[model samples]
Target: MINVVGFRYCRLGTADLEETVKFGTDMIGLETVGRENGSVYMRGDDRDHNICYFEGDPTDHTLGLELADFDALDAAESTLTTAGLDVHRGTGEEATARRCMGYINFKDPSGNSIDLTVRPFAAGRRYFPGRDAGIDEFSHIGLRVTDPREAEKFWSEVFNFKTSDWIGWSALMTFDEVHHRFALFPSDRPGIQHINFQVSETDDVMRSNYFLRDHQVRIQAGPGRHSLSGARFLYFYGPDEMIYEYSCGVRMVDDTWRARQFPVNDASFCAWGSKPDLSVLEGPDAAE
Candidate 1:
């Protein structure tokens, strides 16, 4: 059931890829659309690129997802090699270094890194930031999971995500309808625990919270307001320490939405009362 559909790009691994592509374009506004082999390509919207840095192991990560052609990428690599996992299939120069026309790769029981592509590559216009901060797109993410209920039951049974709420054991997943594109977080190891991007309101999340405090950066919380996707966030800290967000209004669900449950404190992670250190969703190795 690996139907995913789209949420492409994120191939990070940076121990100074030109100082994280100049801190993702002069401090997280992202735009630089291309660099080759050693990788770089950025963008906040207008697809074709969403994050690629490279060079290597700053806790290397990868997350591209999208599948609908090439027979749903050969039926999601034969349903993740018949469910035992260990898929691979991406060649052709690793699908031209993942600008994608095909892809596979795997690792999910909390090891993060998944790719799944098929036909991905779109931007023929729009997107030109490099420093707008009011940029909008490249939305959800915050994965890291040692075992948030076996990574939300292996992404709700091998990939069509789902859950849309829950705070203690984390969760907030999604397949579509925005409410979340994944929020898991219960780390011990495993990467990406933040990297959202939607911004175009709440004054671009309080003008990037004083433009990341006059460029000293390191904010790590909100401009406030998100009791479950009501968005309007801020969270900072970039480059190798990762974690960069800049939300705005988010809240869209369908199928009559439902999922709830909010307990792990701080007004369920902010509701205009910011207090960031969620202890990384208090996973504590989630029952190691």
Candidate 2:
């Protein structure tokens, strides 16, 4: 097993870096920390950065995960190679670009880029948001996969991710279990489906619901509670139609948690009956 130790950061390519960075600060309430080489670093909580946006194709996305140390990273590279996936050991300059001590990058079975790193940098200063959105930390993400079953098996077997729950074939998986680190959503293409930040309370979720609406940002779904994780959430579309979420009061599990399956439907997605296009969550197989 790869033994993932942290769900750290995302490197996303945006069509216009300036616009995306402005939207992130003015609308979504992220703090801009630094900029270099056309990449803008941002964070919701105090780590070096949580997401980096660069000017490039909007479809390009990479998720960064932390390993225990260089030994674990070495083991991960060997494991991925033995499994027949090509792995690139990151150069020192590339590791500096990723804000890590050492790293390797590879594509998952579904072609989503993943960076496994050791000694990711942390900030000495605390985070201060551009807006008081009550953001607590950068949390989970939704990863798009071509096949849910295959993706589930690959993550659960090849790495330490374990399923916390499922809506249809899609799995809410975690390594350290703050509910889920990756919410696997089946799609025709591979990329990050959504980025999530945990806010302080339900009021944060509801407040952002109106705040985003007044700002002319498109509301994607929810000021509703999720049935699976028991968190109140608000999702909105930012630049390039990328989804960002703020949620609070998520359930946490230990070894005692039992994974349960829920059919793809309105209640499975939300407890308060706010209908998001359920097809977006379940993908092409929703109507089958």
Candidate 3:
């Protein structure tokens, strides 16, 4: 297994870099950290950056995972290569661009880009938000997959991510104690379904809901509690139609916790009955 410590950051390509930066800072409340070579780096916590918006095709997105060290990274590369997957080592320039000491890039079974890095950089200074969105840190991500089973197997076998629970075919997975660092949802195409940030509390979620409404940002779902993680959430749309979420009060699982499965339904998704426009989870052909 790759022995991933946790999720590091995400790199998103956007046609309008400036607009994306504005949405990230103004709407999402991320602190702008740096800008270089047509990319803007933003952070929600002490890490140098949790998200990067660069000028490119909007479909180009890369999720980063932090490994313990160079040895673990090397083992990951070898393991993936042995499994017949193409892995590319990051060059010095590439590493410098990402503010990481080293990294390797590859695509998952669902064709989502992933980077495994060593010694990911963090700022010594504390994070100050551009707005009071009440963000705590960049949290889990929802990954759209054509085959949830295949994607789940790849993540579990390669990175040793454990399933915390299941809502239908969607798998809520974790690397550490945090409820879920990643989630796999069945979709026709591959991309990020949503990027989530944990907020200070339920009040934070409600505050952002009103803030987003006044700002005219499209609210996608929530201001309701999730049945699975027990988190209060708000999903809103950002630039390039990228979905961003603010949530709090996520349940943390321990070694003694056993994973449970629930049928894919409104009840499984939300305890308060707020519905999301999730076409990906609708059809009879949806993930098993």
| TM-score per candidate, chains pooled | 0.34, 0.98, 0.97
Error of 2 at 121 (Å): 0.1
- Cα lDDT tens digits, model 2, 186-255, are 8999999999999999989888999899999999898888999999999899999999999999999999
What CA root-mean-square deviation does each model show from the true structure? 15.3, 1.4, 1.3
TM-score winner between candidates 1 and 2: 2
- Residue 190 of model 1: what lDDT? 86
CA lDDT scores, all candidates in order: 0.85, 0.93, 0.89
lDDT of 2: 0.93
* Candidate with the larger lDDT of 2 and 3: 2
Candidate maximizing lDDT: 2
lDDT tens digits, residue span 1-288, model 1: 878878987888888899888878887888888889888889899998888888999888988888889988888788888888898888888887888788888888877888888888897888998888887789888888887998788788888889989888888989999999889888788888788889888987887799778989888887788898888788888877888888888999998899998988888889878787877888764554
TM-score of 2: 0.98
What lDDT does model 1 reach?
0.85
Q: What would the per-residue lDDT of candidate 3 be over residues 1-288, giving only the tens digit for each residue?
A: 889886889999998998888888888999999999999999998888999889999989999989999999889999999999999999999999888999999999989999999999979999999998888999999998888888888989987899999877888999999989988888887888899999999999998898899989998887889898999999888888899999999999999889999877777888999886656565236444
